[model samples]
Target: MDPVTFSPPLYKQRYQFVIDLVKKYKPKKVVDLGCADCTLLWKLKFQTCIEVLAGVDINRAVITDKMYRLSPLPCEYLQPSERPLTIKLYQGSVAEKDPCTLGFDLASCIELIEHLETPVLEKFSEMVFGYMTPAIVIISTPNAEFNRLLPGLNGFRHKDHKFEWTKEEFQNWAQDVCSSYNYTVEFTGVGKGPPGTEDVGFCTQCGVFTRSYQSEGSLTADSCRDTEHSYKPIYNVVYPNLCDGTILRNTVISEVIYWAESIRKNMVECAQEDETVDNHSYQASSKSVPSVSNISQETCSTEEHVLTDTRGDNEAYKEGNTIFIPLAKLFSFSKVQKLCSSLDHLKAILSETSQVELNSDATAMILSAVEDIEEHAEACWDTSCLELGVALAECEEDWDEELCDS
Candidate 1:
């Protein structure tokens, strides 16, 4: 099945909406359900001062170190700052009952529930309301009522989406959940709708549920346990230190950071050994040939030999440089600086593009630009650098492929 790809504009709106809510709520413990690539977590970490951030995705592939590094949101973005973000990653389906043991102040599942079958969604509601009741729950799903706004849009926005609820259907569900859980819910739409359909004109609908004061006391961990809800520790961080792009991409920031570190250490050791050998040779030559005439002849011969071997040594050095200097100037410092600038530009593109409707042509251009960056990063042969590019490129490629599928 083809994967679902979200538009840059939609992503921006979703992020901003969630970010605004986070700012308003000021929840210290945040949980992101279906946090694929943990994209929002990276944003929230910088945008807010959340004490604990947890990401749970059903796709186990995303939990692996390889995918985590290659799945966008670079290591530099997830770095330690003056106000550090303590992040935890888990792999498990949200359909499971009380998937996580820890309590959260706020929970968000953006553009996720539609992908689940109706039955799973029912269980999900139970999991969220009946068992893992947080103080606040925020959800965003595609609005079936607004599919008419999309050009050539058919059936559902994505094939994986089991169903998209109309505004009434969504409101009904929200009201039912709130009533059952003794919570109060509010509604908002994400995208611009037709002029006449202002109230229900959004491409996506959002529901924010805040538990009532009286309900808080009854919704405890002990109460959840009484319901036979057992929390599983299936979610784990195979690689905790996924680089966020603040550090040099060549260092210990990739899936292969350990290997790269070892190779770099060996290279340093080899260079040191070569320096020692050269020093010993110079000392031995000076002691053995004490005569001034001999020294002079020796110096003349060495000069002559160096001049003769210079061209050959250069050719040999160029060939041997890869082995000797893995981190050695594959690309100039200027090039890396330019690449960093280009990445900053790409970030601008992401922000700017989100404000307007995205087309296939624009998507192609964006993907091409990201690929160009990735290609340059790959030349450095640093997994951290290469994977940063890989993540961006993959994100675009997935979008392109999904567009084709659409």
Candidate 2:
């Protein structure tokens, strides 16, 4: 079957969001979990400097010889010669593959959770988080609230989907998984509408878990929904903060910061070790070679110093200097920054208002932050950055009154 033919409209938007995140991380090797036709892998190959982009899927139909010929766009776009990107397709299940063994820098499971049984979902999470040491993993699934908004009961029913989850359910489940395995959890989405809209029906939630790391739980679903829903739409988009450009920019900045810090720490450690070794060597050699050479007095000493300096310069050439920063760490810093800024903004608004009561001040603060981020994200147009900017702008349209107040 042609995957795109039956796919939802929001798939494009979701794909763009995932691709942006991947680019921000700049993974050297990317593994797409449950990649139906690897359309996302093909698109992401163009956006980031990924050396290896591989897709794993259970459906053999999507990867057959005929399908490769039939679906030329994805393959053509992924061709290294044409685009400076390399992609590999693997037909299998994510649970079966060990990401650590594969040495993937980053991995993604987009819109694949609803199809798995609970046990399978748990296993899948373990494989990605436990076995796969990828610094960053992106997972997205349908929001139950949006599913309810579908035309009828039939809307929630998908032939392949084992189960659909409400926003609360997915959040709760994700929090547990992240907490168990030391991963940070974040929630965001695509499209413009009220709490739920058909065009942006699916809820794109990304669980960015790092190895053996934990963060204090901040906002709960009820609290978040209360704040988010009370704040009326300023434009066509629902939650302006979740816009694509803002997300991409935030992710990119955070990744850079994280990598920079890691590099600095490693350099400091290496320098300390080098100093210790030099001190030990000098102490031991002091006895073998007289502190002051018994040369032809001053003239011999001057000639010996010059030769020592030359030898020192040549010795420096023997040591190689190379910098290495894991791609996942580099990309995640931007995500951390964006998410931190967003949470801070949310906290600032919440602090100004009563927990039981939602006020206009809180709404205004949210709108202001969204606008500020959107303004700053103008330069990033590759992939879905431009479209995301427009979406956030439209969501802000409903906040005109709030903007005026500010």
lDDT of each: 0.61, 0.53
TM-score of 2: 0.45
The per-prediction CA RMSD against the true structure, in angstroms, equals 18.3, 26.5
TM per prediction: 0.51, 0.45
Count of clashing residue pairs in every prediction: 12, 21
Q: State the displacement of the C-alpha of residue 77, model 1, in Å, after optimal TM-score superposition.
A: 13
lDDT of 1 at 58: 78
lDDT of 1 by residue, 84-194 (tens): 345666667787765353478889999999988889999999888766788899999988877765667878889888999998998999999988878899898676754
Kindly give the stretch of ten consecutive residues in candidate 2 with the minimal lDDT sum: 228-237
Candidate 1: residue 146 lDDT (0-100): 72
Output the TM-score of candidate 1.
0.51
Stretches of candidate 1 exceeding 4 Å from the true structure:
1-8, 63-84, 99-101, 194-200, 214-406
Best by TM-score: 1
Which tens-of-lDDT digit does each residue in 1-406 have in candidate 2?
1121223567888887777777677777787777776577657656636656667777767654332421224333212121233445555566553322246777788888888887888778776776555677777776666544444457555788888777677779888877777777777766444432455444444455444543232233443443322121111112222223344343333333334444545555677798899899889988887864553588977986785578531121111233333233332344444444554443343343221122244221111111222232233223333554465466456456555673
